[model samples]
Target: MTATGGAAEAGQGPDQDPIRRSYDTVAQEYADRIGDELAGKPLDRALLTALLEQLTDPRAPVADLGCGPGHVTGWLADHGARAVGIDLSPAMVELARRDHPSAEFREGDLRGLPAVDGEFGGAVALYSLIHLPPAEHRAVLTEVARTLRPGAPLLLAFHRGSEARHLTDWWGHQVDVTFHFLDPDAVTADLTAAGFTLRAHLDRAPYPHEAETDRSYLLAVRS
Candidate 1:
């Protein structure tokens, strides 16, 4: 994958600016911890299965944005989608490539994707958007939309929240990392602003082993 500077750098405020840096610092540990969990977990598999059901065609190219360790990307490839994984952290990209040899993994920023316009048939921004505040959501969605063909499927997953919250968990790498959560209606609004129509949404309590949190999902289509 090609690399470049000047990635839009739009739609970020003080509270959210530190998040990227935190993820960069913890990229490796984050991948090591969550990679295998997401790969074989029944909860994640169920979500992917549901997502695949909404896909319009069997053979379609997919972009797995913020793909950590290529678990979901590899799954999509196995299911007949030409999948490519992209992430902001180079270490995460490296780990993803090492773990999932069949799929393509690239170090790239979501705010400014290197993908050609209308290149992907679908995109998955799973659990990645939670890092940004609500204000930046639409801009990121618009960027994702630009890479997808009209009517292409896009699945986004995140924890449901009534307001933005800052967090510091030691599970990943060193520096403190913060995540922002949004409610379902807010997510739908952002998707609509990005020229997508909500197809289906699932709100389920995470499994027993999962941490206690409000989880929500949305499967939308480009318009």
Candidate 2:
């Protein structure tokens, strides 16, 4: 699933938004293929555990923003956080709910989240921000900050680069989505401007079986 905004209005309007439509079209296949991806990424699990550990109230809801098939969300729940998965695609949300009944999933936009101010204890946006254009990065981050409590931990992962990749076809299905490779320094600046204080930043080369792009992870706290 994908989480994005700045291109259209909120709510389930996939017919009007190419990104949502594309994800909806491939939601099932994406879940089938990527739902268990975290099993192979030890660093991802470690970071997620760190995020949960930092939350002041472990019972307070932790949002898995742009949570595709709810695998990460379910992982957080299993690890003791009250995890809620939010995605822009209705189909993705449906599949997440169907597969991970213990965790809650909602259909919402990243730019305009369907959450009240300071509703979440912490949040994670793994590879979700790449779907958004650079100009809208801070806006979405600001929205995320608005929904998180002060000092709430936020973990973000993205492709590390200065290039933008667009896909017109994926997994035998027609799609129109652009994945933005962001610079860690630029994203750190954006986090600061969005009311977050960076606590950790790490970059790593992709695993041989993974996409051929460098990856960056940032751990920040709402301030």
Candidate 3:
């Protein structure tokens, strides 16, 4: 069955390495495809603009977690903010560095980011958390909170629906990758449990490839 996000499921499995390996191998293609679309009209940019409007200072440090090809990182840098991009795939990090020379793209896993504690004023993870098990969402959110100063803003973008179904990552080329879709309400609960206050929750129009029924976004602030 096609993957779907839903209310807390009872028997979800832990994140495995096969998915990471698949992504690493296809990182270049993934970066290329997503980069082209995002560069044209970035979802992260639109959300970030809204987020920055609420910030007291837009120049503060902001991290683009799971930043593929550094599209949003480049946007943040261009807008005069201290922006850094982090991704688990070395190929993606390489491409992001080459394409966005001005922005910093580091190779790291989001499950355990290497960002300095409380150094960032904001953070974002566009479609990056979907692979995590539902149970880990709170831990990941806590990790995100740890890297930001108190009251730092954070934006997490993910596809939404109603159950935990696993499917191959279908960007073509026959790679075997999988991800868990997140339910918006459960994600919000995870964020709140991680010490963040709900700021905004939006179900956006699906981007080109995203099935119209499964696209969504959530923006939150650290309390």
Candidate 4:
């Protein structure tokens, strides 16, 4: 999180940009802190299991978009899915590869994923979409839809609200990043616009030891 100017001001796109660098700077500490988060989150694990159960081919490839440290991807792999973790930070990708050798890991941007069209049987983006601006949500969801087979499921999770929070200091690192809290209805509309049929929409208060914001999860099928 060296002081790189705002990505927009720097004329750099989202790929390999400030957000990526910010995450890269704190990747190790972030991984060490949150890597095993699912263990404490029963609802998250349940939702993920639900997503896996919806997959038409249990062994088919499942992309973990914005995967950090590969924990979720590893869980998917352990649960009988061909899980692949993808992230924008090379550092995160490296750590993921190191930690989860059984599952594949790669560097990729959500706006333009590194995969063939309709290649994924399912996808998950837990707490990942909050990094993108709301204006870009629809386009990103469309890109995600493009990578999934017909009727493939997507499980998306995000902070639920209508506010943006910028962090300049994180775990003693000077990072530049913004987390956008999103409305479930708006995201549902974006999913519909991106050719997804909504299956479920859920929201819950934060569990103790979690961030204070409420969280939203949407399960949808690519149509």
Candidate 5:
């Protein structure tokens, strides 16, 4: 959870550049190849169900931040939550909109979303924050706190590890991005500092048939 590499210059941070550029570059290929991934992930499906369970009503607006190809958003809709997908990559947004016509998708940074204060009852970030350096995580959580109504829940999924990873290429395409593996204690501390009441934290080794690396999920409520 320690800061690594370099920090952004004053008045700017991680969301402004690298993440957007890299994801936008990979959006199409990612969508075409991995859009239906949730169909194969049972644990993720159960966690998402639990995410909606915290909401008092199924119709409450629940956002999928860094929604990528929108499969999770669509799943939320299918299961009950009024879901809208948001991402920092325009290309990803476009693919999400096209691929998952049942749900809505928008492109925007997590540091400053397009939603008004207290506009949503729930939200989820599925493996989204891994691209963010820890220096930028709290501010993003602050924004999440602002966007969610009091007592609303948010679920986050990320890789679990001590070191950071740099990817120079993905899906045979040249791209620049950094993915951070996080410690649960550090993530909980950031969520608590951002005005969230932590509800649960869980981690497990990756599914045998899925991608490598351990995974973590945190469920928190806006205070």
Candidate 6:
């Protein structure tokens, strides 16, 4: 599945946003180091497999919202789903373009997607939502719902917690970004309120050598 978003709902949106710039500062390094990261994570791969199976149109592009470096977007392609990866960072889009020329990457924001209503067949947000403040979750999900076909599946992976963490540096690069950990119930409620049929909510302990935080995977269908 793919996830999608536009740079902003209005004009005050994602372009050059701190999160975008933060990722931009490390875009090439991130792409070289962790872009193809799903290869080592079994659960993530399994979830994507399930997502791929649920897509209604095999040839249609899936939206990858908050698609950093377009790795997950390419992963979707590896599994046979056409994908369009969207990010707020132009540098990330450029790295993704360089790495996976076969896929499409655009600079966008999750609050508003540029696509026509129901433009996608499926969507995925792999840890992308973690960057947004909780208050924006529903608005983003609402935009998600608007851009997807009815009953289209959405797969989400996120860190689980009760607060947001701000990082001043990452991978040895100076940066400013906030990561939000969320409760599954709250996110599920947000999805329901945004016109989606909650499908599955799964959480797992972090594996060795992975980020030292619990993770949650949610599967929902557009209503």
Which structure among the candidates has the greatest lDDT?
2
lDDT of 1 at 198: 97
- lDDT digits (tens) for residues 1-223 of candidate 3: 0011111001112444545455566667665566555554465568888776665556667888877667777877887778888776556667779988888877666556777788788887777777667787788788889988878888877767665545554566454544566689999999999999988887867666645556667888889
Q: Each candidate: RMSD to true structure?
A: 4.7, 2.9, 5.0, 4.1, 4.5, 3.3
Runs in model 5 deviating more than 4 A are 1-15
lDDT of 5 by residue, 80-195 (tens): 67898887766777877887788887666677787899889898887767766787788878988999988999988888888887878877878777777888888899999999
Q: lDDT tens digits, residues 1-223, model 1?
A: 1011101011233543454455555656665556556544676577677666666655667888878667778887877778888876555667778888889987666677878998888887777776565777888888889998888888877878865545565554445444566688988998999899998898878776666776787989999
Instruction: Return the TM-score for candidate 6, rounded to 2 decimals.
Output: 0.92
What C-alpha lDDT do the candidate models reach, one value each?
A: 0.69, 0.84, 0.68, 0.81, 0.75, 0.77
| Candidate 2 runs further than 4 Å off | 5-16
Best by TM-score: 2
Per-residue accuracy of model 2 over 1-223 as CA lDDT, tens digit each:
4754211112345543888888888888888888888888889899998998899878789999888878888999888888999988888889989999889988888878889999999999998788777777888899999999999999999888989877899889998887788899999999999999999999888876677988999999999
**Candidate 2, TM-score vs. the true structure?**
0.94
- Write down the TM-score of every candidate: 0.84, 0.94, 0.84, 0.93, 0.90, 0.92
Q: What clash pairs does model 5 have?
A: none
Ranked by lDDT, top first:
2, 4, 6, 5, 1, 3
| Model 4 TM | 0.93
Off by over 4 Å in 3: 1-16, 39-44, 164-171
Model 1 misplaced stretches (Cα beyond 4 Å) = 1-21, 39-43, 53-57
lDDT of 6 by residue, 1-223 (tens): 1112211111135433667667778778877777657778899889888887988887767988878888888888767778888877778788778888778877677776657798889998887777666787888899889999987999888888898778888889998777778899999999999999988888999888677998899999999
Which ten-residue region of model 1 has the weakest summed lDDT?
1-10
What would you estimate as the lDDT of candidate 1?
Answer: 0.69
What's the lDDT for candidate 4?
0.81
lDDT of 1 at 175: 50
In model 6, how many backbone clashes occur?
11
Tens digits of lDDT, candidate 4, 16-127: 3768778788888977887888899999899999999999977679998888778888999998899988887777888889998889987777777888999899999887
